[model samples]
Target: MAKQLLAVAEQKARQMGLACDIAIVDAGANLVAFHRMDHARIAGIEIAKGKAWTSVAMQMPTANLAQSALPGGPTYGINTTNQGRLTVLGGGIPLVRDGMIVGGIGVSGGTSAQDIEVATAAVQAFAAAHTHHSTGASRTIR
Candidate 1:
């Protein structure tokens, strides 16, 4: 899964001409794999890990937390409670299998949209691999 995720993300980032820092985390938010593309922003290293961790911890796409993490929002100070590991960014996605989160993927060093797209590639691949529906539909995918 890590190899496939890295290959897919690397290809996507290359096609888009953007360097990336990609990280994968297990269900417990433990780092499983990581890769930093040439010229990727140094800051992206930690951000990528945090994104994956945040996704697994929250069990949702990091983008979905953006609004809630804003000032005055219900989860406004949520970031402060995670020991500074929470990242409500656009590139983090939880990888679900059989209705449970199996892991997470995170991407950085690109625009928010690009980061999401890269992470989505990994999510899509994981979904396709675990497809259960006979009609080629994934039970845990969107």
Candidate 2:
């Protein structure tokens, strides 16, 4: 599943003409798989991984954290609490299967919106695959 998710994300990045880094983390926020596209920024590797970790740790889309991470927001200094591992970027998304957050996916090396777009594609692929194989539980990506 990790490899499949990476493939789907890379395909989307190719379609968008982006060179990016993608990372996946398990429910415990541990690295599952990662890919760095040709010409992708070196820094994006860590950022991608961080995004995935942040999503799983927070159990929410990283984009949503951006708001609360702002000055004077509820989580204004949340980023500073995790050894600076948390990022309020838009590319991270939680992968929920059977109503449980099973993992997370993250993309970097493009604009926030573009990263989000690519990650979303991966999530959609995951959902489709789940739907094709099983029929009972709900799946969500956010």
Best by lDDT: 2
- Candidate lDDT scores, in order, read 0.89, 0.92
Task: Quote the positional error of residue 126 for candidate 1 in Å.
Answer: 0.8
Per residue, candidate 1 scores C-alpha lDDT tens digits across 36-109 of 99999999999999899999999999998888889998889888877878898889999998899989999997
* Clash list (residue pairs), candidate 2: none
RMSD (CA, angstroms), candidate 1: 3.8
Best by TM-score: 2
RMSD of each: 3.8, 3.6
Provide the lowest-lDDT 10-residue window in model 1: 133-142
Q: Which residue pairs in model 1 clash with each other?
A: none
Model 2 Cα shift for residue 45 (angstroms): 0.5
Summarize candidate 2's per-residue lDDT along 42-104 as a digit string, tens digits: 999999999999999999999999899999999999999889999898999999888899999
**Model 1 lDDT, residue 110, Cα:** 87
